[model samples]
Target chain A: MKEILLNSENYQPGLSIDCVIFGFHDNQLKVLLIKTSYDNKWSLPGGFVPIKEDIDTAAVTVLNDRTGMQGIFLRQFATFGSIKRKDPNFDSTVLDYFEIPKDAGQWFTQRFVTIGYYALVDFLKAIPQKEDNHEIIEWIDHKEVPELILDHKEILDKALHTLRIELNLMPIGYNLLPEKFTIPELQKLYETILDKKLDRRNFLRKITHIGILKKLDEKKSNVAHKAPNLYTFDKDKYEEVLKNGLNQGW
Target chain B: MKEILLNSENYQPGLSIDCVIFGFHDNQLKVLLIKTSYDNKWSLPGGFVPIKEDIDTAAVTVLNDRTGMQGIFLRQFATFGSIKRKDPNFDSTVLDYFEIPKDAGQWFTQRFVTIGYYALVDFLKAIPQKEDNHEIIEWIDHKEVPELILDHKEILDKALHTLRIELNLMPIGYNLLPEKFTIPELQKLYETILDKKLDRRNFLRKITHIGILKKLDEKKSNVAHKAPNLYTFDKDKYEEVLKNGLNQGW
Candidate 1:
């Protein structure tokens, strides 16, 4: 942990980036979190921004360093800035974890303004990397996320809010689900993200009318009930909608 | 300007806030900008965030000080942090405007990471206040916004992008329009914000289906063509939809 701090000599003193990496599996949305050595509390994958790199690049670097994933769909959602965001208690906990003297941990106590970036990745494809201090990385269900360090819980909540709003306007669900999915599976994903029950008939009608889904000639395999037809996203039509703009908010 | 800098002794050293104050008038969207005292270049209404105040509070204070309007709908959208953001030439220009010595202007030359906030206001109500260094305050049409100083233009573009996306999920148009407006007027407002021409029949159908507008018994007066029925936003219904969530991006 101390070595981690020493390696951040080129980082901007008061700015950092935190990533809320979301994935969907088993009909549940999940977020990747790391257990910090200090207090062993959970937190979003985050790191300081090096002064020489762009903030967007820094966010990508942090994501790669923590998740060992590349080319993920990432978006900068919000910036969190409060005077006491990095409280003295948290700093002391870091000092204890790193075994660094009080004076040497000044860098950890300074006021930090963190930019929040949220990424959507395929759950099975992501590989978690162990850090010097944070050796345990886990993908916690969104509903079961524990209390995180500092304002990380608030950041995660905001990321979820942003994701819900974005899902309404963009085809971002493609990043979370498998390449081929059934209508019920897609509806389940929507329900999980929105945290509400959507009318199946209406959802199916609306999604079909969007013209972004292509019906395939295949059906689900070995299902207890009737197997539903599988479909894939029409990337060209989705791109067209993105370029020509879709009618929103009905 | 030097006096202004001196008064900001309590400001956080490397952080600031910039606002994109948007208003609606004559069926056109407008943005409020201030002309710099040094080179007469236009820029967004912005200032440093005081060390003792929260970033959100600083945004409101900056908006009130520059636009003389409070309690407006202001939202922090993004943060801009590029390495060459605070070019020395710009700092020199500020120093030249303030008639400060080179050594004394060192404080002004430091790099600053700025948070971008956008405010929606009623054009007829906001009263622009003149500052010591910025005596000229102008509300230019969105399409006619001049080249702004530093990265203000990019900030303004991002603000507009956020505003367009937000308009779909939330009823924010009420903040820019009058208490009562015609359906055509509302459609035009959407068109201007979206920067695209929408099918009138489709737009009307979509807007009505949203169920947020209440038709009044009044009609537009002094019109060349047929007088359109007037309508106002149904606040309770809008809030209900927002609470329960609306089907978006169709």
Candidate 2:
């Protein structure tokens, strides 16, 4: 396997794609990470770009394989290409663990200019399917992510930074909310991300006026019998409302 | 040179950096392009990434070598990696132009996943430098850009798109404006980018309120003696004000 990977004909040399699969669970932003069996070290789900394939296509393929197709909202954010981006300690550990490599480790040891991609997904939908070499797969809160292999930690931090900027600048709101959620749940999601309290009646009054929230027909909620138990954003309607601008006072 | 390039020991194989050097002049956005002596074909100011150098460092070096050090605001926006992004016609032309033996041309013919960087610079600042293999070098209006080699046209379009979005979403007002300019020149620059005429009185009234613009004490304006002839943005102060937010009606 090491010999096959060392061959340059199969993949583009010194280029890779790492996916920062973000999910919102327990009101916290989470990142999907995998533990490789070789070194039992955490790493972002990533792979080399096949010689004949596009970089983005490689990202999608790698993401699907890692998460059983969880990364639906994909964006190529930035590239990490620093000479010292790789971790020498991680490399030595992996190389020492798998002793079939000396000269064969050149491909694995070279400096890789990795394209960083972020994927926004609902946590429930990510059914992680472990690869043959993966010892563990888990979604850890962004704030609590362990020390990752290579420059994965730097890549993860950058993805979160871009996400924060996007949330502040654009009309993309609460995209990580569950498939069907109550208004209170939606409000909680907003409050969690913003890290501030909101007036209950005022929040309800202001949000209802925009009419982007569609009341889903479901069982009554424990808190409010008058309000539907579940509601979802009418994505098209929400976007249409946003075109004219919505001053939600964020 | 051809033999050396084909050998992967010198450079990161299949990875390149293409720079979109944007300048606003004559009320139109411009991009710097170089016509290669190899094919006499127009291309973005670009070069291959050396094995040891960072991708962004490579971009700065390439930009400086091409434009005598004018790309001051450098940002890596996207990566172009379509399998068919390369121009086979260009490859044949260059290979035939150089009369390189078929085997040695592999380096030129292979697919390169290029990192796209956009540089916001004052147009007059970019003094075009002809590289050893460049037949011609010019900064052409983006709208009037000639057919560029490879997928550079797509890359250029993305850069312009990002620029427009940035201008609209943030307090990045008239960054393309000259270092020092009068109210009228600033208004003209904004109008050109916005693609619409703004009311003269309303423009001045609204712009002056933020106090981000500082009047230079050099001279009085040609239009009105009461107004300063040249004004420049207090970038630091402007950013400080934006921290609280500025609502410039688009």
Candidate 3:
């Protein structure tokens, strides 16, 4: 591959974008992670921002390229810029993995200020694909996420924090759930993202009181016990609540 | 003066920091702006982020250098990175203002991705200062702020939006008020920030119900009407509310 730093005409040398793609499945919140060619270490889907593209657009492109999903709920939450952000030995590892000369790897190792964009995608609909031959993409339970390369662990933590705060203000969790989901399923999604068990009765009372959910007559099927009523988010009501602000205490 | 882009040893070329220093005084919310040497247009107090410094620290340094305030409540809200962010004629303006050759002005006019930080400072306590001979510092009423250079107007608006959302979740308004303030004074501050007329009874009732304020026995001294009781933010209570999450809908 051509050295990006040497060819600065196309890419901004010191800037990059990392995406934390969150999805909910099996009553667990999960994040998409890729095992890199270098030492098989896991990393968030990331890439350099092209000089000509808007940063926001670049983030969306990166998300689409990595997750095989488009037009999702993607938002830039934070930027990480620490001198020690890249692992000290990362360059040498990349040099060995790419089989590139040391000089060529210099550009890849240079300090970068990465803008983080978190995305919430429907896991069942998303078709995760490997971006290149050297990497493997997989979904891992957020609670069971392994130690990530560089400062990715920090980035993931911040994404989860932003997601939790956003959950209280907006009906974004609906993006991770099916169109018609039971209250218990929705509550489980919240508990997973928040990493805490919430009182089910309180959660139901509080969420219903917000008046954003439309209770459907249908119920969950093929369940061992009594199936719970399914509900879908009322987009109009959600937007109205967002405009008026939802002060629901989580 | 040496061109920053040519002398990349000290600073990163494409990255910069812009500060939205919000202050409250005269029962009005205001932002600190700088009159630039080029076209005398106002801009947010901003400077380049040095290659050696973390982006977060650069924001704090820029805030202190511009406003003469340290250890204040400053937070990074967003980063603006549009290819069309710099005005079309900004390069020529810089060339004329700095008396630099066109070649040298290229570095000054390069596309910059500015990370925006908004600071909440007590208007009476902050001593705004000019950074250099080419700039003049002034505080303009938030509502009366004139058209600014590049996407600064958008940045300022985003900062205000973020601040409003944050006001509901955190006790950030205390940063703009004095240690001991009356209820009316505090209510006026909220009204100014939210840019709306809140019901007097409702506003007071809601704020007090949050239980983060200590209702002191003291009252306003210099007032013609009944002296409203003085109160100070109870930091401990605020922290508890923040930890438990403030779901109080405004």
Q: Which candidate has the highest DockQ of all? A: 3
Query: How would you encode candidate 2's per-residue C-alpha lDDT over B1-250 as one tens digit per residue?
Result: 3444544677788888899987788877678888867654588988878777888898999888877764377789999899886657755566665555666667766788889998877777678887654368888988788888878889988887776555544555444666788788777766766567989998888778667888888764464547656888988878786564544334
Candidate 3 segments exceeding 4 Å error: A1-6, A92-96, A99-103, A240-244, B1-6, B92-104, B239-245
Report residue B203 deviation for candidate 1 (angstroms). Answer: 3.8
lDDT of 1 by residue, B1-250 (tens): 3454432255665678999999999988999998866655788988877666778888999898877777898999999888767755664666666666666665566567789999999999899887774468989999999888889999999999888877777765677888999988888989999898888998889888889999999998888888899899998998787666666642
For A190-212, candidate 1 gives per-residue lDDT tens digits of 89998999998988887887799
Q: If ranked by DockQ, best first, what sequence of candidates would result?
A: 3, 1, 2
Q: What is the TM-score of chain A in candidate 3?
A: 0.90
Quick one: best TM-score, which candidate?
Answer: 3
Q: Which stretches in model 2 have alpha-carbon errors above 4 Å?
A: A1-6, A90-104, A173-175, A194-211, A217-220, A224-230, A238-250, B1-6, B37-41, B90-104, B169-175, B196-211, B217-220, B224-229, B238-250
Error of 3 at A48 (Å): 0.6
The 0-to-1 C-alpha lDDT of every candidate, in the order given, reads 0.81, 0.74, 0.83
Residue-level lDDT tens digits of model 3 in A1-250: 3354433566766888999999999988899999976665788988877888899999999888877887888889999999776567664766666665676666666678999999999999998888668778999999899878889999999998888887767776667998998888888888888788999899988888888899898988999898888899998988788776776556
- DockQ of prediction 2: 0.46
DockQ of 1: 0.60
Ranking by lDDT: 3, 1, 2
* Model 1, docking class: medium
Error of 3 at A71 (Å): 1.0
